[model samples]
Target: MQSSTKTPTAGGRAAPAPWALVSVLAANMLVDALEVSANLVALPAVGAGLGLPVPQLQWIVSGFAAGFGGLLLLGGRLVEHLGRRRVYLAALLVFAAASLAGALTDSAALLTATRVVKGFCVALTAPTGLAIITSAVPEGPARRRAVSLYSFFGAAGFCSGLLLAGLLTAAGWRWTLAFPAPVALLLLAAGARLVPRDAPGTRAPRGPGWHATAGGLGLTGAVLLLVYGLSHLAGPGREPARAAAAFAGAVPLGALFVAAERRSPRPLVPPVLLRHAPLLRSALGAAALNGSYVGFLLVATLHLAGSGRSPWQTALAFLPAAAPLALSALHSARIAVRLGPARAVAAGAVLAPLGYALYPRAPGADPGPAGLLPATACVGAAFVLAFTALHLQATGSVPAGLQAAAGGLYQTFVQVGAALTAAPVAALYTVGRGPALWLVTAVGAAGACVALGGLAHRGRPRARARP
Candidate 1:
């Protein structure tokens, strides 16, 4: 788990240039992010082209999430067991293939399947990329800066996806789908050249055998059901009975997973990590922030559209929220290093609630771009301050061997937060924009408290154990 003096590479080849390595990995991160936002804007066009109903069309977005969120834990375990570089490269190739398939597919189900495949591939690549960074880069300012760059690219990719969708969907939704394939291919070629080789000693310990496999499958199934159930709960046509059934199913599967892991010599998730305060707090804080931001976005988008603004105008207006993100993220590492990740997160957390509170709350209120500027700017700034810090807190202290597993667990929290929050926020928006914004503000406030709570009794020394 210790930091290596030199970047790890296969067959004793020279380490890739740091810039090249980070850029390639960050680029892949961008591709994963683009999958989420680009399809969002293209959804209506996709439905029209495929003659799909509104309810089915929603799957295009939710399905990707299901795949991404469901298998994240298993993906993390795979990265550890299979080799980070190997898993990352293989997943990238599959992601590119899926993107190509998605672009060409005429059938709605097939397109959705392609999306799920791409998402699953992303689940593999994301944690591996982070694991690579944690292992290749030395800890301290260098690792912090590398993580900042990685986080920045993810933010930039989402924003770019929105703008790209606006342009590509003009030609056809297919163009939007096809664009990522070439970009992913370019990244794949670069990754093959740049990603460091994994050391042989890094694989999971021998002897868990079927216990490890069963635990992993059970955990994956449980998460899959949870995400799908949550989606059903929040989808346009809320299927409460089905959602309840899925939740009920997840309980036993999850219990079985716990049992299997307890018996396994090497559990998929190390039992100690379950008690890791930093990881748990970071996951909770990230979840709260992600959920609130996504909820806010949903409310803001609907509010803009209802006020008679064009889609392009609404997208452009939201630029204030996404444009400054990369810049802020670039500086987050420095901030976290200085103030500590916990305090930095708290600082960022405060801005979001303030932004939400400042916004006009009335259902009839038309907050044009000018009126909405404060809220968007605040939320954007919040991400800049907290996002990287949260990442730092979550994985920074984890042992090198468990980096991917830790990253997966943290990211699962984030994805679940975004997915679960968006649905309820949408359902609430139907009740009233005021209530929806209030809910977002409340979530943000709670997140801020969680972050601040981490700072309690700062610098207090732990009591010594008896000799």
Candidate 2:
């Protein structure tokens, strides 16, 4: 782990320096999320470096998710137990070391190990960043703004990573892996200087227990099985025997996770979260919405530029979608406050699929600024609206103590949605651009349906958002 140089704050406590502090927290979360897709543009380079089989490549990234997503709850607990300041610094150092190691390594095993380690660091940091937001910024708009920045960075980092990876991979794969090192260094320095210090809680648990470890292992295996099963069965050219086996494999793990969680004393994921009636469905909506939303972005980009679209044109087209989000986000809080979170999320769900429905009608037809622009704008804007509302609805419903865990659970669902349709989403572009997009649009509608049934109600002023 990389060492942090923290400064003393009020009460002679070690803390991060104050100055647009929310931006700093957002930056940290953004960096972590971007790593999810950071290597995509450099896949060829990384594959060569690691001597990877074509099939093994996804593991390089999925392994990180396996590490990060699995440990997120544990990471939050560790932060509470050890003190956010210490955990934040230690996690940054780990990330830095892994980034450096990734840059220097040629061995697939070594690079993948570093990625997994970095992911572990990221898991620790993400929830802690929100915790920091809650602690540092007082409630209401201040914290809301901070969280907005965090979410915004996440969106921006993902988009930027693709662009940056493209540029760097053109130079060499090392640049893509190495790019994060300097940023990590800067973040470490800033974090040490600015983040506030809080002493370890006397009552906080010592560390993660077997129950927690088992929970993550069980849950991840279940999710991976589920993803593989669906991917193979529905995806093009998929083998029947293998797909059947994958489906068979997923069933036991899913059942085991449910049974295990129901009994564990120190449960990996607290069962209460899974049982939250409104959240259970809303989280599914968030996952489904994002899965198709990001899926569209991935395939749309590939279809546009995968063949011959120039870098500038690709950037230009995406920007139209990107630009409206910032403007629309300014109104998200107000809309949620007035309209309620459930409706807000449902509205976004409708808009995204609606945009997809339009794709076929107006395939490549220049509909001027209002026409072509609004379609993608709906996709991005809906993302902002739904995700923000999900945060408000899911987290706000929970007791204060359970907020981080709830947030993590919500995020896990989002990842599940994203993971489920990789092959199906791929088939869209691989099969035919128009047909593939329409399929994605239909999937988006399916997600909207999930949101509408469970978490998709209206007009009740509930708890306000947590930063």
Candidate 3:
């Protein structure tokens, strides 16, 4: 792999600073994470302004997930085939444009469309940025630190988005949409100066064949349909028929994608990644963390609302869950080195369920912020311990050239898993919030089991790069 520690400039002048490159990438990741949580707070305002029903309002959030989760794998390939810097820059430009358009739009459908467009843009940038970090920062302690910093930005962004959304909504929901445009532009300027250009020889010698292209398209469509279905189940409309149709349609598309991969000279997903146990476990662990957190957020907010807390108050109450994540960036590298990534992940996974189980189960029980701290703090600790480790486990095992694809796969699991887990949990909310919490706890336990399972193969050595 080419050294990203420093790159030669054309003028032989001082090169762009390495930390600057990482900051540009990490900041963009913050933008992506912010988008996911921010709009959710603005959903009611959006519905009131656009005169849309609950179902359409739900799309304002779900549309982004569908587009992002669906396109990630293909976006990763594009980064591999094209250059990471090229794709990253172009995606940022499009993201800025989409954010601007979203802010100006009055039509509900147009707002959702812009969200989907921005999601596609994020689909390109998020993994590309991750791939850049993995390739640029050599493996071992340095890479762990870099990955931890990247993961911290994401966790912090999600937390920041909620608070920002609360503040911005008072000005009007459009500000929520408008906020990221300038942020993207700023990142774009810095990225152009900072992100190293892809080496001339970095591009693939040959592009995907017709079979691979077909398989890629099929796989993307299948993922889109599946996520869309799963997301709608949790939407306020609760349109089971539409969700069922999407689910039913995805089966055949997925089967065809599998068949095509078998026949293609170059498959959409590398076969080696398929057999990689560590990556798979990492993906599942991330899924459990994200899904349960999302579900808990929904259930917790509803519980708080029942106690007459305003949305702003609810956002504040969750601070315990988000603060540790940002701080974790500083120490996660040490934790990973000390405990091993797998063990760290498993240990963190165990904490989440314990926290969920500790949450006050009765609807009438109004746990003040202080009472809620233990639960939220535990969830936050889970992220501190596991989130960065999960990223490390996912990409560390893959070849440097395939880092982007591995990132895409890992993120896909995270996004789609949130939808899948949150759906049934949401449905169970009507039955009882306690059951939803139990479900989230169960998922966390299952994730912990999966991570623990990876520990059995004592003879298998870890994949690493020599510094």
Which prediction has the highest lDDT against the true structure? Answer: 3
lDDT of 1 by residue, 1-467 (tens): 13234455456755666766887888888878877777766766676789875445545665576567666766766666777888888888888788889889888888878876777898888767876887877789878878877888887888887788778877888998889888888988888887866665877665336776676567657765765575465435578998899999999988888898899776767776787777888888998898788668666765765676654665677778777776566666787788788777988899988888878787678878678999999988888788888988888767777775677778878876766565556555656788778888998998898888776734554332111
Give the runs in model 3 whose Cα sits over 4 Å from its true position.
1-15, 47-61, 106-109, 130-151, 205-212, 231-240, 305-307, 395-404, 427-432, 455-467
**Candidates' lDDT values, in order?**
0.75, 0.67, 0.77
lDDT of 1 at 126: 76
- Candidate with the larger lDDT of 1 and 2: 1
RMSD of every prediction? 4.7, 5.3, 4.3
What is candidate 1's TM-score against the reference?
Answer: 0.82
Which of the predicted structures, 1 or 2, would earn the higher TM-score when compared with the native?
A: 1
- Pairs in steric clash, model 1: none
Q: TM-score: which is higher, 1 or 3?
A: 3
Q: List the residue pairs that clash in candidate 3.
A: none
The positional error of residue 198 in candidate 3, measured at the CA in angstroms, is: 3.3
lDDT, model 3: 0.77
Candidates 2 and 3, the one with greater TM-score: 3
Q: How many clashes in each candidate?
A: 0, 13, 0
